[model samples]
Target: MRGKATVLLVSFALFVGGVLALQLERGGVRTTLLVLVFAALGAVAVRQTIRKRKK
Candidate 1:
């Protein structure tokens, strides 16, 4: 479970990093969408981590 959580956290970090890179390079509606997608993924990952920790 810890391994899974770690993977998810890393994935979320990568996703956010990618979105930031896209925004920096492109700067447009597409970048906004990527940012939103990354935000959602990060939120889900955080929630899962918290739930697993509680267990």
Candidate 2:
């Protein structure tokens, strides 16, 4: 429980920081980061699916 809570807190903090940074920069940085994040998430999801199928 403690570990889960710590992870949640850290994730929330990072999300808030990202939002703040996006607001500060209305240029390509925001778009680039958003694409990178989505690509990373998609890769993780695909990897998990492949592993589950292997099992």
Candidate 3:
């Protein structure tokens, strides 16, 4: 239950970051950083889900 909630929160954060990145000008470091952060969040969410399911 908590794990699911965490995943949802992370996903929402990633979505918002992605949207903000899209709205920003292209070819900037901020956009790249946001994308990297989103990717990391996604990876963490996936890992948490898999770990919880395995347990």
Ranking by lDDT: 3, 1, 2
lDDT of 2 by residue, 1-55 (tens): 7855765565566566566657766678888776665665566557657867998
- What are the models' TM-scores? 0.51, 0.58, 0.67
Off by over 4 Å in 1: 1-27
In Å, residue 43's CA in model 2 sits off its true spot by 0.2
Cα lDDT of model 1 by residue, 1-55, tens digit: 7877787777777777676667565657667767777777777778778978999
Candidate 3, residues 1-55: lDDT per residue as tens digits?
8967887887787778777777777777767868697778879867987887999
lDDT of every predicted structure (CA atoms): 0.74, 0.65, 0.79
Best by TM-score: 3
Q: How accurate is candidate 3 locally (lDDT)?
A: 0.79
Error of 2 at 42 (Å): 0.3
Error (Å) of candidate 3 at residue 11 is 0.9
Q: TM-score for candidate 3, please give it.
A: 0.67
